[model samples]
Target: MVKRTALYVTLVAGAFVSVFPYLLVALTALKTPRQLSGTEPWEPGLPPTFANLDRVMHSGFAGYLGNTLLMTAALTAGQLVFTTFAAYAFARLRFRGRDVLFWLYVATMMVPSAVTMIPLFLIMRELHLVNTWWGLLAPYLLGTPYGIFLMRQFFRALPAGLEDAARIDGAGPLTILLRIVLPLSRPALGTLAIITVISSWNNFMWPLIITSGDDTRVVTVGIAGLKGSIGVDPNQMTAAALIALVPMVAVFVAFQRYIVRSVVLTGLK
Candidate 1:
């Protein structure tokens, strides 16, 4: 009983640590600027107001939200399609130097984006993709090395009997991949999709470098601008931040079961 009590206490403490920041941010969003800037950070008194949220929305938050959603959805879909195909080939298909090529791909992950930022920017400039949504979406769509690696690991863990049986029944590689492997790999793919969406939605550095105008500015970058323009308006900033978190939170909550299972499988493998 003591051990169980200790374990429960630890778990509850951990949960509180994870959730407390979000709770603070949520409540701050409801506060007025005066309350937020005052000495006491935790005191509660007045009724919550939506004026901050209203101000954020009127200040082009809607446009930023739309741009972020579009980019995130596009990047996630592209990663899912491209990573799954590449992972399947690496896992099931025999080819010359496949392991070498896969290792090289993984090696790129070790190379920080900062190292290649200049080159990537110059390439985008040459391609006339800078300051556009295509600029934001292009790098991610080509199949991220990490996404490929994760999918490959998941694919490798799948039973080979399914593929062999499909091949004996006159199924081509493409047919088998589509009809067999993909359906069984939904959990991993869903997890990857969720991860991809969140990463793309929250990406700041690349978007800041590539985009400038209102036409392509995403939520994170937009929030930075909001900060500069609002200048210490904590309530407004908090409201915008809270709003920015909504889509990713909704996606995670909706697919949480699959995400948990995928994480467990990935770790076990």
Candidate 2:
């Protein structure tokens, strides 16, 4: 009884610790400009105001938000399609040097992506893709080794008997993979999609460097541009941050079950 009580207390403490900073930030967003003039960001600006939200919404936030959602949707779909296929090949197919190749590819993940930015930029320039959505998405559309690795792990954990049964029923490789493997991989796929959307939506540096003009700028870049020589307004900045956070929170809420399922099932293996 004591141990169970301790566990519950620990979980509650952890949740509070994790959630408090964001709660503070959200509260700050609700502050009046006069309230924000003082020191200490941790102070909960009580008796919230909606003026900051109204201000931010008028400040190109809707366009920025739309661009982020559109880009994220495209990036997530592309990543899932490519990574699912690549993961299936790695997890289930027989080929010479397959394991070695997969590991070698995954090793690249250990290398910082910052190191490759210059080369990628050059490639985009040569392809005339610079400052375009094509350039913005080029590096990520094929997905990453991490995505492949994640899906491969899930695929590997699936029952072989399922595939065997499909084969015995005269299903081809494509049919088995599409009709059987993918249907059973909802948890993993949902996790991947959510991850892809969040990562793509929050991506800042790449979009900042590669994109230009009002049409191309995403939410993260737009949020960063919210302040400048005029100095940062606590209310405005926090309000924009809160706006940026909404999509991610919604996505996590929507896919949390699948994320939990993936963790539980994958951990057991």
Maximum-lDDT candidate: 2
TM-scores, each model vs. reference: 0.92, 0.90
Give the winner by TM-score: 1
lDDT of 1 by residue, 189-255 (tens): 8888878877898899999999999989999998888656436667777889999987778987787
Instruction: Please identify model 2 stretches exceeding 4 Å from their true place.
Output: 1-10, 38-46, 261-268
Model 2's alpha-carbon lDDT is 0.87
Residue 180 CA displacement from its true place in model 1, Å? 1.5
| lDDT (Cα atoms) of all candidates against the true structure | 0.86, 0.87
Model 1: colliding residue pairs? none
Clashes of each: 0, 0
**Model 1 Cα displacement at 118 (Å)?**
2.1
